[model samples]
Target: MGLAVVSLKKGEGRLLKSGGMWIFDNEIATIMGSFVNGDIVLIHDFDGYPLGKGFINTNSRITVRLLSRNEQTVIDEVFFEKRVRDAWEYRKKVVDTRSCRVIFGEADFFPGLVIDKFSDVLVVQSLALGIDRYKEMIIELLKKVLKEDGIQIRGVYERSDAKVRRQEGMELVKGFIGPEFPTLVEIEENQVKYQVDVKDGQKTGFFLDQKYNRLAIQKLCKNAKVLDCFTHTGSFALNAGIAGASSVLGVDASALAVDQAAANARLNGLEDRVQFLCRNVFELLPELEEKEEKFDVVILDPPAFTKSRSSIKNAVKGYREINLRALKLVREGGFLATCSCSHFMDYELFTQTIGQAARSAHKRLRQVEYRTQAPDHPILWAADESYYLKFYIFQVCSDR
Candidate 1:
């Protein structure tokens, strides 16, 4: 088959030359022919020189997601196997836990694909139409790689609930590929045990990316009061309680999540020290403050507020509001660990939002650490968007 061609405008060569893979709608001079969404396209400069190969999507603002910069290379099954094997090798060497992100989209040279390893199971989410088109090849490589490593390959689950999939003109898909569904899976990270529900739990059944950030808070939890906002399954609260915090409170809006959090605390034998509350975090923060409830350590790991450029400003406001309230509720010399998973909100913007919140709350804040996703979730330097996870741990002091 003749290659579908995408011709770039005059200066767009700069973005590609500088290692950017995304070709926005505005960058295209003209698309040579009609291609189905996720079809491979050969990108060319205005001079008609072959630049790279990418996945085409007529529906999205991002028209092309470049797969390889080498113009001569074909994106075949063997090519995908090589990428998957490289991603797997890096994760096995870097990540200490079995439950970790195996491939983090652009970070692993396979943009729009994320894979999480949970013990014997692998959960995959293909966010881009391009990667979705090659799902079979990717899965085949994953199975082969796991088998070669002597790892028990039990099942593969697909969780493509992300809104990006819709933007890519793909339908949501969730189910198991193997014989049996994993009802419950236990994973240990930072000396804490977590039960994951691969069939229904959020984002591949667990927030494995936050493994390091949760452990950072553990060091400061000795005999201190702790509060975990947006506590999906009580990972933070349980860690605090296990670290000898005097008391730990976990709050989340979902009843199922709250129930699961309570059960998780009990599973870790920390029920006596941890409490779970099912309430909206935006409302609960102020209510807790009005009741004169203060905490020595507070964690706010909310869902992504902005999925695209249009919502970034509003998301910043939401981030500021929650951090402002949380900052006010922290006792003097207390610690605050907050995070945002929105790729649209860059690290500078996110930290600036937190700084603005501290200024408004009349609190003195000193950042103790700036963290990102764990090693397994490697961020490719060439693709900045893959570095979406941002975590900041700060020491709070009253201006008074």
Candidate 2:
């Protein structure tokens, strides 16, 4: 079939005009020519001006995810080779390529795809139906590119079982892209070691986006008591212990995660200094408060409370409750590190929520720094969804 042309309605592609990669179904005026869903299609302005090319999926609200802004661009192995190489090259310059986000979906201009490197293993997630069609080619190309840089990828795993795939008319599935190997992978970051369970662990085995954020809290933990809530795999707690913290307690409700966290503590030789607890943070925080327990540093790294905008109000309440409880536990002049991974909760809303929490806890906050996800998870400006993870560190002072 010839290239299908999708023309946008007058003044309907506002987001696209502003440099976003998505073209909604309602924004389309008409489709000229014939093509199947998940096929490459040309985009045209209402006046017949070429806007570029993208993959169209009628099953999703995001009808078209722009692949290239150049109309002449071809989609093939040659095209994917360049994209994969460019992504790897960018990571080498900006982050530790040993284990980092090699391809960050829209941020890397490969919308609907995410690839993370954990030691020698590659974890790939192809969310959109269009990208799923080329997933194999992209993975092979990425392996070739990394090999040129002296990196031998021992295995490739697919974690494309996200629920969102159904929205694109795709099946939920995950397995090895090639021959299966041990799913458990070991990785080191900020001088701390962890065993990542790629097959059954959280997104991409580990949260590589927080790589440097964990590093930032090291100095604050020296010879101090630390508390790390929602400590999946005990990342922050281990960092504290490695940084000479007197003691560290990591809490997570998941028994599996707690066991992994405890194992990680042992792996880092910090089992004595760093400990793991299986408990609901919401219940434990108040219990600790009643016991008058205080910590020199408290880190709240909760999983996203709300995945959609409709639930953002409840998400705010959750963030506020945790931050307030954490502030009350911070000894006078102590530090608190809190962050939200939800994109639905914008920066302004998150900051405002923290301020409310401070007031309720009667703690005066002195802002030390504001941070986002690590550089490897680049925030593409025009693509707002590419920018999540708002992190902040504050000094908590007793209200006089």
TM of each candidate vs. truth: 0.95, 0.99
Please give the CA lDDT of all the candidate structures: 0.87, 0.93
lDDT of 2: 0.93
Q: What RMSD does each model have against the real structure?
A: 1.7, 0.8
**Clashing residue pairs, backbone N/CA/C < 3 A, model 1:** 107-380
lDDT of 1 by residue, 1-400 (tens): 6878999998886666777668888999988876888888899999998888999998888889889987789889889989888888887788774788878887777878888888888888988988887886788788898888888778888898877687778888887766776568887778778888888898788988888888888999999999999999999999898899999999999999998888888788999999999999999999988998889999999999998899898999999999999998899999999999998989999989999999999999988999998888777665677689999999999888
Model 1 segments more than 4 A misplaced: 33-35
**What CA RMSD would candidate 1 show?**
1.7
TM-score of 1: 0.95
